[model samples]
Target: MDISTDVWGQLALEASQVYLTEGGQVRSPFASTTIEKLPDKVLLNIFSYLTHREICRMATVCRRWRMVAYDTKLWTHVSLRPEISGLHVSSLESLLALISIRFGPSLRYIELPIELITHTVLHELAAKCPNLTHMLLDFSTAMQLHDFSEMQAFPTKLRYLCICLSEVIFMEGFMRKIYNFINGLEILHLIGTYEKVEEEEEEIYEVINVHKLKSATPNLRVINLYGINFVDDSHIDAFSSNCIQLECLAVNFCNKVTGSTMKTLFQRSRRLTCLLMNGCSLRSDYVMQVEWEKSSVQELDLTATDLSTECLIDMLTRIPNLRFLSAGQINGFNDSVLKAWVEAGTARNLVALDVDSSDNLSDEALHRFLSRHGSQLHGLVLGGMPHITDQLWQSVLQLLNNANDGRYYEIVKANFERADRTTVVRTSTNCRVSNYYLLSNYNDLIFN
Candidate 1:
């Protein structure tokens, strides 16, 4: 009475067929699990991962998808910049139409090009977008406006505002208009274009009186003034004294600023964590004279500055929580500086280190530093170092590889040139290295 293997298989197939079919028609188990049957919330979550153009295309699929694609939540943060949006919106009328139709009350943050920012546009944004809180206007173009009275129509609810302006003569009036309007601003970034001038000459434009701004925006938390040559000690003193809640301040490429202001900021701004003073003339005696305090500053960028090694080492001793340090292109950043910081236990919390163009750093000093601290670093920039040989570079890489636990650390950017006799290495995670080159003086190297 025992059944054969073929006979048992046939019987089992017939039994499965009986359950897989009803009314003599075969049916799939997933027939009821179609995409159209998905909940609107799930569909919106899926659409959130799509680009603006892709979301628009998905709208043409079905009625339900159209509704989900056009959800106001999906259009909260919109970038009208041509380079970012990938849509060349030519006219103000078209931009206005898009705002009124697509991104009305749902708009929370927007980046608008300077050309699109007009009186009517500002008025429309204020009237239509009640939830708008962050706005960035790029004025890096050639278009100049003599009057910025239209800024008075800006949304009062804005907390973060960034204005990228080129070298314009009407900075005073423009800034006055902005300060008068956005009194409740918390984060303000005023970026200006950097122009090369002769050493003895100066580019004199109407200076922005930041002292007035500090009074106007009392709730300021973060201020980044890049390439603004007019910002001096008085301006920074105003912000340091008034903006007590300031957390981050960047005055990169502002040559007019010196170490006097740095002392003021450190003493006054107790909550400051990030201080970026790249390309500023911090070579003054005031930098060495200040009494270093145990401050909360975490990220310090002294790139292309003129800080003496003693000053830098003394400063590092005070910053116990210092995580990111950029000391590139500084003449005094030699092995002694590295050794001093490491010995003083200042490099314990350093997660990112940049020593690019520090011509004085030796291979031995770099190798020792990396051997001790390279494993925990998420970012390391060692570009423009002619002193570091290929052998030492390989040892540094080996140390990092052994410590990374088989996880791939991406070489975000690695540029090598035999002409300059320099190697640039920038490392992070989640990207693949593309190109590799061998110089005549250096061995074949591939960063992973």
Candidate 2:
């Protein structure tokens, strides 16, 4: 190995040297010596497979493990998603302090549990983990916070930011600072927020205004906003004009955004790679698939919206690179559209296809679609297609069983990702509902 490799190896050994332990719960030092003497690189590899919780447990086994658990390399991808119950709120501050200091600059990715995030915590992260990049903050339970001073110190390296906030006040308050501080921000996703009614009440909400934020995040590539009632086509026009390099846009469950603005978005954001507008009040004529014929969007989800069957089919046939398509609750997204794609050979490239809740699709259409392209598909959401019978899943399993091709397993695995680090899947001999999960060994299913 080269000199750089040697240095890394030596660091790992110094970081995990086994020492005597007082805990009777741990295996005797001499007993585990064989495992401990392994090369430092191998030991690091073993630690890499462990989650934050598992590492915490391992740290208790021995003095040497405690050191290894705190190693900077092992703290890069951390999750603060654990729910803290029955403990004083001060415990959260302690935990955050420990993580920020011990993890150091190595921490890059973090996912905070809903309502647990606070202005103080974000500041701590920015100061301690200067290399932090991606952060997923859930605001479902987050307290109403309107401070933006700490956010001004946001880590310079921060890029992708997905904040699911609960208050419109907090959402609009932070955007101004986000653009100013997080200059490198690429993806800004703001989900629906809440407000109060009546002037007498302390709680009330106004529409989110991001018009001023354009000056800060001029290079933003992806924008996802949901339920901003005050926004109209003019806001979309301004965003399209300002964020000229936008590649992905998703807006859902909103009324102010008209179909005309969506058309302008489609036309202005020419480099867009993904578009999702679920429940946006877009006129049928404005969002015709023909408008997107020459566009570069690869992933499109227009759930709960209408597009002509002919338009759906035409878009599928025309967009050879479209890899992810979902039309849930949309009319004219029947088996015929799938057939048209199959005949055109464009469905072969699709990684995820969701026609869920499309009542018109029959079992025959799904069977033909799956048989022709099942092996290639990584995700298939088949729920709500009533015409498809239980026998359809059985036959799908049988096909995979006969050929041993593994598509059936892939579909099941794609359907749901296990949330916990340690997941024990138990498959039964007879299941009431079966679409793709018929594997004999549930534990053997590999997660992507």
**Which lDDT tens digits does candidate 2 get at residues 1-448?**
6997897676666556555568534433344345568776777779889777777788898888778777889888766666631112245667676666677789887777644465667677878888888887766565565455555566678677766656533566566555557678876766665232344634435435667766567778877776655555676677788887888776766555656766567677888777766666656566662366667778777777767787677777877677777777877788788889889887666666677677888778888887877666655676655455556765765433333344333223222343222222333232223212322111111111
Query: Model 2 Cα displacement at 220 (Å)?
Result: 2.3
Clashes of each: 0, 4
TM-score leader: 1
Q: State the lDDT of candidate 1 residue by residue for 137-208, as single tens digits.
A: 777673576355655576889988887766653556666655667888888887777775667765567345
At residue 348, give the lDDT of candidate 2. Answer: 60
Model 1: lDDT equals: 0.73
At residue 66, give the lDDT of candidate 2.
79
TM-score of 2: 0.68
TM-score of 1: 0.76
